[model samples]
Target chain A: MKVVDIYRAIADSTRRTILDELCEQNDQTLFEICARLTNNHGLGLSRQAVSQHLETLESAGLVKSRKEGRFKFHQIDSTPLDEITARWPADASRSSPDASRTTKRASTETEEQS
Target chain B: MKINWTSIFVTDQQKALDFYTDKLGFVLKHDIDMGGPRWLTVVSSEEPDGVEIVLEPNSHPAVVPFTEALVADGIPMNQFAVDDVEAEYERLSSLGVTFTQEPTTMGPITTAVLDDTVGNLIQLVHQDEGAQG
Candidate 1:
C-alpha cells in the first residue's frame, strides 16, 4: 500500500480513536473496539461499521489483525507515525521564510480588521 | 502554542496524494509502513517545517454522511495560503484541477476553491504583500 493510504486510514476521527484504543490496549477484538468507543468516547457505532473502518485501517497498514481460533485480534502499529514527526527539523527556526511572512501578514490583517 | 498539523478527509488516499502533490505542488513529507496501513503526510514546499496536512481516510461510519453534507453545501474542508491565487489557479488548471470558485478578491484576501478529488473542497487564498506591515 502507498503512503497516502496510511494518511487516509487515520484521517477520520473515529479511526483515530480506534487507533488510540489499540494503542491503549493492544490486541483487541471488534467487540472490544466498539465497546471502548462507546463507553469512553460516547461514539455509538455499529459492529459492522467499525469492522469496515478496521479494514480500511488494515489496508493502509496502520492496523494489524490475527486470528486466534474463532476470535480475531487487532493491534496498532505506530512505526509509520515516526515518519510524520521526522519530516521537519527539530528547530523551529528551520521553517522557510514564506511561512513566517504569511503568519505576519495574517496577524497584521487580524489587527486591521479589529 | 503553534498549529503544527491538520488533516482533511478523503475518499481515497492514493488519489488524494497524487492530486495534492502533482497538481497542487505539495511535497511528500512522510510515508512509512506501520504493519497495516502506512503513515503518510505532506507539507507545502514553501513551509516544509510548518504545518503538515494529513490526507485522512473518510472510512468511518460518520464520515460519509458528514462529508457528503459538506460537499452538497459546497463548503471547503480547509484553506491554504498561496502567493497568488490567480497564478496558482492557472497552474492547477493546466494540470486539470477543477475549481468551483475562481479567484476573487474579498477585501484584503483573494480566494479560490477547488475540488480535492478525495471528497472535499479545498480553498486557496492570497493576501496582498503590499498590505503587510
Candidate 2:
C-alpha cells in the first residue's frame, strides 16, 4: 500500500472519530464503525462515506483492513502517527522557542567539537 | 396485526435449514413444498410457537447483490435476542460458527454479529435489564 500524508488523512473529523473508535476497540467491522459513529458520536454517515474515509486512512497507513474468511475487519495502526511527534517532540520544561533553539545549538557545537 | 413471520434470504434452503436447526438450535416449524423453493421456516427452541424465521431462497437477481453488500460490511440481516451474549458467543464459537464481531456493549445492549453461512449475517443481542426503550 502506498503511504500518503498522515496529516491529510487525519484532517477530516469523521476520519479522526474512526481512529478514536478503533482505539477503544482494536478490531471492528465497517458496520460496527458506522453504528458507533451514529449512536455514540451522532454522526449518521452513509456506509459508502465511511468506506471512503477508511480508504483514506488506509492510504496513510493509519488503518489496516484484514480479510478474515468472508468478512473484512479494520484495525488501527498508530505507528505511522509516531512520525508527527518525532518531527516535533513535546518538551515539558521548555517554555520558549529560544530555549529549544539554544539546546539544538549546544548539541550541534558538541558534535562539531568531537 | 401481529408479525407471525420474518424472512431472511439464504443462498440454499437445505444449508440454511441445517445451520438454523442443527447449529442455532431452532426447531423446524414448517417445510411445505412451494415448488422450486420450499416454504421453509424455523422457530427458536425456547419459543416453539413464537415468530418463525422464513428461510427464503436468494434466487432473485436483486437479493444476491443486496445480501452481498450487507455481508461485506458485516451487517446482520436479522437479529435474535439471547439471555447472555457472551455465553452464546462461547456456545456458538464452540459449534464451529464464524463470528465477525464479538459481544460488544453499547449503552444498554450487547450485540455480536456472526455469519449465517447462507449469505447473511445474524446478530445475537442481549439487552440489560431495566433499560428498555
Candidate 3:
C-alpha cells in the first residue's frame, strides 16, 4: 500500500469522522456508521455517499470491511497512521532549545492563569 | 504542543507531489503504498521534523463545491512561513510558479500567494524581524 493512499483516505474531514466513529466502536455496519455520523456529528450525508467514502478508506487500508450474513461490517485499521506518525522521531522537534523554552513558558503561564 | 501533521487537498496527488517537492523545495518524508493512492507526505527541507504536509486527494463529494468556492474567491486554503516572501516568490516564479498576489508588506508581515496547480491557492508569508518584540 502506498503511503499517499492513507493520506488521501484521511484527507476528507467526513472520512476522518467515519474513521473516528469506527475507532470508537469497531465492526460497524454501513447503516450503523451513517446513523452514528448523523446523530453524533450532525453529518447528514446520504448512505451512498458514506459508502463511497468507506470504499476510498478501505482502498487506502485505513478501513477493513467484512461480510457476516447480509450485513457488511467496517473496522478501522490505524497501522497506516502509525507509519505517518513515525516519520519524524519524537526528539526531532524537541532538539530546538528555543521552542522547548517557549513551550515551557507558555505552559507555566497557563498554569498560573488557571 | 507542536503540529505533527497538516494537509492540503489536491486534485491530483502525483502532480501536487511534484510541484511541492520540485517547486516548493519540500523533501519527501513518507511514501507508503496501501493499495490505491499512496500515503504521501512532505516536509520542509529546513525543518525536516517540523510538520509533515499531506497532499490529500479531494475525493470527497462535498470537496468539489468547497474548494471551488474558495478558489473562486481567490482565497488561499493554506499558508507557509518563509524566511523572505519576496525572495521565495522570485525563486518560485523562476521555477514556473504562478503568483496570484505579489509579495506585499502589510503591517508586521509580508505575504505572497501562489497557485499550487492542484486546485489550491497557497500563501507564503514572512513576519517582519522584531515585529513581535
Candidate 4:
C-alpha cells in the first residue's frame, strides 16, 4: 500500500476542485474533468496541466485511474484522509452541536469495541 | 468557398458505415470504391446537404498511433450538433454504444463523448438557444 500525504495532495486549489468533482460523480475521463473545470469553474486550464495535477493527486493516493475499454477514467479515494482525523481527537475541537453528537457517537463506538 | 466535406480516419470503412448510418442515424451521401479504399461519406439526416463526413481509411503509418493517442486521452476527433445531448446519450447507450464522457452541462452548452467504433471519439453537443460558441 502506498502512503498518502493528504496535505500535499490537497494543497492546490485545482486539485481540491478535482476531488470535489470526482466526489460528486465518480469515474470521469480526463476530458470530462477538463471540461468541468473550464465550464463549471471557469478555470480554463490546458489538458497537460490538468493531467499533471491528476498525477500529483494519484501519487498521494487521493485519486485512482482505471482503464475501461478504450478510455481511462479517474476516481477519488479519500481514505488517506483518515490519518488526519485519527491523529487529532475530534472531541477536542470547538463546541458545535454536530461535534457534540459526533463525540458522543465516537465514545459509544469505543465502548462497543471494548 | 463553402466548407462542404470533412474527413475522419476510420479503422474500417464497412464498420464505420454501419455505425454511422444504423447507429448514429446518418444518411449515406456517397460510397464510391477507390480501388483499395472507398470515398465514403455520410451526412446528418436533419441536414443531408449540410456537410459530408468522409469516413477515410486510416492506412497511413502515422494515422493509427495518432488516433489511438487521441482516443486514449478521451479527445473527440469530430463533433456534431444535436438538439438534446441527454436524450441522445440515453438513446445511444441503450444501443450498446460506449461513452467516454456522459452528458455534462456547462454554462449554456451540454456535451457528451462516445466511441465511434472506428478509431475515433465523437462529441455530441447541444447548445442552449442564443448561446454563442
Candidate 5:
C-alpha cells in the first residue's frame, strides 16, 4: 500500500468507519459488511456509498477481498501495510527529540564535499 | 432513532471491548468472525437503539496520522457525556485506565482526560446543569 494511497483511504469519516468495522470483524461479506457498518458503525451512508468506499479501499491495496459465491469478505492486508510503514520517511512525529536529523545529515555530506 | 451499527478506532480492540462492555455496562451485541480477525461490537445496555460504537483496530494510515498529530498538539477526541466526570474518572482509574489530565472545570463544563489504552484521548464531561446559565 502506498503511503499516499493509504492516507487518502482514511481521510474520509465514512471510510474510516467502514475500515474500523472491517478490522473489528477481521473479515466480512459485502452484505454483512454493509449491515454491520449501517447498524454498528452509524455510517448512515447509502449502500451504494458504502460499496463505493469499499471499492476505494480495495483499490488502494489496504484491504483484501474474496468472492464466496455471492458474498465478498473484506479485511486488512497486514503484509502490504507493514511493508509501507517499514519504508516510511522520517518525520517530526517520531519519538526522538531531534527531528533535524535530515538537515544534520545534509550538513555532514556538505562538509565531506568541501 | 435506532442505531444498529457503530465503529470506533482503537490501538487494541480487546482493551476497548473490556472498557465499554465491562466498565461502561454496554452489552455485547455481536462477536463474529470475518475470517482471520473477529468482529466485536457492543450496544448500550440501557439504550440499544441510541448509537452503535464500533471497536475498530487502529491500522488506517490517516487515523494514525490524525491521532498522533492530535496527541502532539494536545486535543481530545469526542467527549463522552457523563453523569459525573469525577466518578467516571475515578472508576476508570481503578480499572488501570490512566487519566493523563484530571477533571478541570472551565466555568460550566467539568472535563477529565483519559488515555483509552491507545493513541485516542477519551474525555468525560460533566454537563454542568447550570453551565448554560
Candidate 6:
C-alpha cells in the first residue's frame, strides 16, 4: 500500500475512531456512527465532523460509504491491499565453504588485456 | 515530517504488543481503544519519535487472510536495519523471541529472521560499508 494512502486514511483522529466503530459493527449509517463515537468513545464530535472524516477515508479506500434511502452508511473496505510489501532475501554466503568465490575469469581477462 | 508508523490488523493484539516492545525493545507509543478492537503502536527505541508500528486487530476478512499468507510463507512483512543483527538477535532470543532463520551472512550483509506475533515476518540486517561489489 502506498504510504500516502495509509497516512491519508489515518491522519485524522476522528476517522480512526470511526474505523474502530465499524470494526465492531460495519455498514452503519452516519447517525449510528456519530452516536457511538459521541456516547461511547467520548469523542463528543458532531455528525458533520464524522462525515467529513468518512469522506477522506472513502477517498483513500480505507472505508466505503453506501447510500441507503435517506442515510449514507459506511463500512471498512480493507481488501484493496494484499502483500503490500515484498523484498528479496539478503544473503551472501550460502554454505560453510573454505574458499571464497570470485570472478577469476574477469580478473584474468583484465590482466591479459593490460 | 514523521511517518505515522503503520497500522496492521492482528488476530491477537496483546501478543503483538508483547512481541514488539517487551521482546524487541520497542517503546510503547499508544495503547488506546478507539471504540471496538484495542489500538496500539510501538516505536523502536533506536529511532524514537521516528516511525512506529501500530498493532491493529485482524478482524476484517481480507486483512486476516493477508496476514495469514505472509505468516504461512515465513515472509517477513518488513526488514529492519540494525547496527548489529547478531547481537540484536541474541538479545531478543534471551527475551524468548523465536527466530525462524538464524543469523546468516551473505557477502557483506548478515541477517536474522524472527516472528513478531502479529503474523509478520520481520528481518534484522547488518550491511557493511561498500558491500555492493
Per-model TM-score (chain A alone): 0.72, 0.81, 0.76, 0.77, 0.67, 0.64
DockQ for all models:
0.01, 0.66, 0.01, 0.69, 0.01, 0.01
lDDT of 6 at B38: 68
lDDT of 2 by residue, A1-114 (tens): 566799999999999999999999977999999988887788999999999999999999999999777678899999998988765567623556677778886786798799
Residue pairs with colliding backbones in model 6 are A91-B106, A92-B106, A92-B107, A93-B106, B10-B57, B10-B58, B76-B121
lDDT: worst 10-residue window of model 5 chain B: B69-78
lDDT of 6 by residue, A1-114 (tens): 322475667777778888887887776656456556765667878656776777778777888876543224577977644324311112324433434434544565587799
The residue pairs in collision within model 4 are none
Clashing pairs in 2: none
lDDT of 5 by residue, A59-100 (tens): 778778874332245777745566556555455346465647
Best lDDT goes to which candidate? 4
Top DockQ model: 4
Runs of candidate 1 exceeding 4 Å displacement: A1-114
Clashes of each: 9, 0, 18, 0, 14, 7
lDDT of 4 by residue, B7-105 (tens): 999999999999999999999999998888999999999998889999999999999999988888898978999999999999999999998888888
The residue-by-residue lDDT of candidate 5 on B104-125, one tens digit each, is: 5545777766656556666677
Weakest 10 consecutive residues of candidate 4 chain B by summed lDDT: B68-77
DockQ versus reference, model 6: 0.01
How big is the positional error of residue A19 in model 4, measured in Å on the Cα after superposition? Answer: 0.6
Ranking by lDDT: 4, 2, 3, 1, 6, 5
How close is every model to the real structure, measured as TM-score? Answer: 0.51, 0.86, 0.53, 0.88, 0.48, 0.50
| Whole-model Cα lDDT of every candidate shown, in order | 0.76, 0.90, 0.80, 0.91, 0.67, 0.70
TM-score for predicted model 1 compared with the true structure: 0.51
What is the per-residue lDDT of model 2 for residues B27-130, given as tens digits with 9 covering 90 to 100? 99999997789999999999989999999999889998888878878999789999999999999999999988888887788899989899999999888888
lDDT of 1 by residue, B18-56 (tens): 988998889999877777555678999988898888777
List, residue by residue over A11-88, the lDDT tens digit for candidate 3. Answer: 899999998878777876565576567767889998779878988998888888875432356789998788775664
Q: Evaluate candidate 5 by giving its C-alpha RMSD to the native, one decimal.
A: 17.0
Q: What is residue B133's positional error in candidate 4, in angstroms? A: 5.6
Q: Between candidates 1 and 5, name the one with more favorable lDDT.
A: 1
Q: Which stretches of candidate 2 lie over 4 Å from their true place?
A: A1-4, A91-114
